[model samples]
Target chain A: MTSLGGDRSIGRLLASLALAVGGMGAGAVWAPSASAKPPAPAAFCQTYPDSKSCTTGFAECATCHTTAPARNAFGAQLSERLAPGTPRPLSDQAFVSALPSALKMIEGLDADEDGFSNLAEIRAGTRLASAESFPKVMACAPDQASKSGDGRWNVCGYDPNYAFRKISLDFCGRSPNRAEAEAFRKIKGEAAQKAALGEALDRCLVSKYWLGSNGVVWNLANAKIRPAFVIKSGANPGPVPLGDYDDDYNLFTWAHSGDRDVRDVLKAQYFVRRVSDDPVKLEIIPEEEVKKRGRATAQPVPADKRAGLVTTRWFAASNTMFTAIPRTTAAQAYRAYLGWDIAKMQGLLPVSDEPHDYDRKGVGAPECAVCHTTLDPLTYPFTRYNGIGGGYTYDDDRLKAYIRGDGPNVVNAPKSGIILGKPVKDLVEWADVAANSDPFAMNVVRDYWKVIVGREPEVQDEEEFSRLWRGLKDPARYNYRVERMLHDLVLTTAYGRP
Target chain B: MTRTAFIPALALVAAMFAAGCSSLPSAGSEPAQVASIDPKVKFKDGDRYLGDLARALNMPRETVCKELGRYDCFSDAFRIVLGGVEAPNLTVHTPLEEAALTAPIALDRAALHVCTSRVRMDREDPANAVLYRASASGRPDKAWMETTSNELYGVLLNRDPTKAERARLVGFYKDVATEQGKPNPDAASDWVTLSCFALASSLESIFY
Candidate 1:
């Protein structure tokens, strides 16, 4: 007969997505007129240095180009104001210098016509180009504040008591039993209670429900790995298991747990084996042992060729499949590990005069060229890594081996490619560039943010989200340990409040 | 306004955004106060919900909720609807972003299953029973329902029911008595079973 108490919003749950909220930043030294000039993304941040979109150091490509070369309403407006009468394809310097004025010129206009002006949208961290992606107006003010049960709850701020209940359920995977709940309520000082929450997290972080086979952290890899049980090789091997994804899961779990380095998920040269499931223990397996013990479906990418989860046999087999240009493979690695989705027009760093369409996939057409310019070159390094037929191994002849079906033009695929507007010699360098990138830190932090906070960082959450990710990459704070970062995260006003 | 603006907070220290990757969102114009109402991050997933029930009932998890007495509800029947992932087999890498419509129905079925299963076990051996402390052989008194509510609430919610909640359960007992017409010997058992269902499937029981 008791009332069931819960809100009715169906928001992101259990951290299963890689939502493409892309912003780009790359190494210095790319000249003003470098390849694919008019870095609209970069110039955007320079113009609106305090724009919410600039928090991560760049704006999403969607802010200007619908799919690069095709400007959105905001970009179209900016185009009209940018260096008027200066011929098409203005120099990067001209565009960069003129960007502020162009942005200011259009500030009064409602680019998306969502009522909010372009400047307001940019400041609100809403999409200036998309009508649906606008900031929510404050509907309720503090004077009209909703009342709490006992009047003791900080209705306007982080409530440690509420946060303790949340942390217990989220991390420990259950509500505290009556005795434990009562004991938490009995803690005297707020600092002591907050300290108790940390201790509880320490205990729960090691629980089986968190690190076990189907545990919360393990499932966080589901969207990234996209495991298919039918073709799975290890643990619950399918009928025709080709390769095991558990290795991929093990490496992911290891990278995110304990005193581990999260960068290892992208930069690890060694494979991790889940040594124990209960009180989960994962250790790096030496290359020699992995090689000698290799079954046909064993982790096929040799230690020297491995790039953490990106180079896992299952990752290559599932995403790359069979293709002359393994654009899907490269895109998945970028989307999954780096949190950029080219499909969503995110993380675009267009290489100039690109998408040679070497395999003749018709990507040279203007409609396709915008993203392909960035995507095709981004895919070049992945082309050298074979798909299903090649056991996902690195092969100099991978392109040549596919020429029979894809034609000899496939062999023209480049071994070097571009990532974040910077050139990389190969996928190994590509992973390294991505792993150390600011986006990688932001993306990793965003993953946990979404998991614990139960939603994407809203305009209100930007400051907290920014601090958490920044601290994650800061050696002085967390030293890149996700566990350490989480300590600061649970303390964030966003996570602790509501 | 921005909900945390009124709170004592860490000063916003913007990381120079040390470059080398595509990113987004910088400190934009402080638009306005973000509403005090943050989105509700509620709803326990199936694993946690079912696990909580199993732990509270002092029953083996396998006996908690079996669809058709065979399949595990969390792993099978209500798996996806209740927020358990079945990846690599179904490609459902993540749980549904929101609780599915059938989620509440699945939750009810799972909760009822565990509650009834516990009642059945306790009825078979009342001397060693964890619930139904008093015999459910006849019409229950108000005092008995109060004790039952506390036990049920403590077992599932880990806290005693409020006075209002106790009053509601007691009111429901009268309705159960009327449905019996005659003083059915099974009225007390039926009342206990129904009361357990109400508490086990309550929203507070399901969501965090």
Candidate 2:
């Protein structure tokens, strides 16, 4: 968020000054001002790097602003308590430096009035801003867990019997038979039972039902690829038949299945081809040979410039669709891959001097400036890629054609852009930084967590959820293999209990 | 005719369909007119229910149930209501978060349809029957009802039905006999079909 502090505009500095001396408008409820300085998230994460919200390298916007600029309960308290007498609208440098002390002042306060102190909630990885969310270490105390009435289900902790049935259906696409469940229950010990469950999961992980076309992995890509049959060109062709999104789904399923590194979905330079459906095998179409598929849906981005799904022909065709400045393309990538939605004012990290009214979109006004500042810089790298009717290739001249319609100023939009505050020259570098970051791993693991658990992780499940996502980032633990992560996932108390 | 003989829950579900079917265009007559939006069910678990039920019953998935014995149950007539997708054509990428208003009607419509179909097939080939083992004449006995309840639970839920569960199924069979006012041969087929329908639409069956 320090990038937002770099704004050199005199009008904004005056507004920050006016908001500061006016008591932040924090003392009284106020309408959310758009694009409050983006540097606050960075400073918040820096102070509490171990915080659960910062596990992905950025604190949630909910931590401070409700819709940002509009402070939530804790944020309101933080605003009043921050650097008590310092001029309101602390400069980026001043705000970053004073935040730790402001946080300390309110540690004892129950901001949400949930009966838990702010410090306790933060340390426990629960949301301090919401009364409905708090730590639950005692929710399933060891002595109260695992013991049962039916011997068929455990009420409070991981129950092998429950998980066996759940895993069979989730991965294998059908429930286990009575004989199989009976055999699983009869295993002599917990370790042996888990081993048997793991073996069963190992077998299911590769089943045609999990990895095949229209299977689990394939369906996960539906939102990411947003496949539409009208423009679909491959096996099940649509009437218009534009660039096929089967290519996008193929790369997604390939990168996520088996021992493959999950990061390849965003960082790989090669294409994955589905060679068979009956057995569900996907082989890499080496970058050198990517041209053989030479159909209308073929990869048009040269190998060295490719960055997995972000650079796909279908991704460009669907999202960019001939915009001179491709904010929609960047926003879709950020949301689809990083789990951050920009439309809802999420993941806003305003870059300084951005939204320079690029393509003359009239986004420099305060209300429009709030989001476009972060969005426009993000869109810059995408300007080199042609969309939809532009032959689906990357070139520096792609923006020149739009200049005729967007005005002569459109040609001046730069290629360099900032991602999460780190500057990158092009999409490949942007993707590389994004793929290797903590948030990338968190988002990847969350996909499986939601599908398997049938819900998003709750406050009570935070500890196990935190451990599992962190494990995905550790080299020796899961090593980025989604299959290995699923083995642990099936064993979690959250998954197995009830 | 079989719809009128099931448990009260299934019967209530059946009554809704009784009204719904009367409004539908008859087969081989003309295409029905569109009334509103149709969002498709595109996810795996969303479409899994009917297919898994067919597998458990050991019938060809498509033949398990059909609307008017023509359109397949899962894919055609009930596709939109049952969470099937109508994508690209309508841009519905996500499946329904909760079951539709007609979900219960569709559940019994498919379950009772399949159960009745299975009993008919078993009657035609008693020795090779999957459910019912072999056709019996007259009302189903307590032991046979208990066995059928366990079989349904075993195939659908992967565990044996509890004693209370088995007792409920047997009691439902006696209720079916009483509903007829006197001993009747069709009550036996009706009992078997209702027993299967109750388990097929149970909370456990629909969820897991």
| Isolated chain B TM-score per model | 0.77, 0.74
lDDT of each: 0.72, 0.71
Q: Write the per-residue lDDT of candidate 2 for residues A1-498, one digit (tens) a residue.
A: 000111011111121222232222222322234447545655776788775554444455567666667888899888887877988667767777789999989889999898988887766556667787775443443433433432334555566887887888889887777778788878979899899999999989888888987777887777888888888886788888778887888999988997888888888888888998878889987766778666676788888888889889889988998798889999999888877667877555566566787588898899887777667888898888888858778888777888778998888888878676567899999898778765577678777877787666654455677788789988999988888889999998768766
- DockQ for all candidate structures vs. native: 0.25, 0.17
Q: Provide the RMSD of all predictions against the true structure, rounded to 1 decimal.
A: 11.3, 10.6
DockQ of 2: 0.17
Model 1 stretches astray by more than 4 angstroms: A1-50, A54-122, A127-149, B1-36, B135-139, B180-184
Q: First chain of model 1: TM-score?
A: 0.83
Off by over 4 Å in 2: A1-59, A71-138, A141-150, A286-289, A292-295, B1-9, B12-46, B77-87, B133-139
lDDT of 1 by residue, B88-194 (tens): 77888877887788887788678767877888788898886776767355546777778887887788778776565666566666544533245445556656666
**Candidate No. with top lDDT:** 1
Can you tell me the CAPRI class of model 1?
acceptable
**Model 1 chain B worst lDDT run, 10 consecutive residues:** B13-22
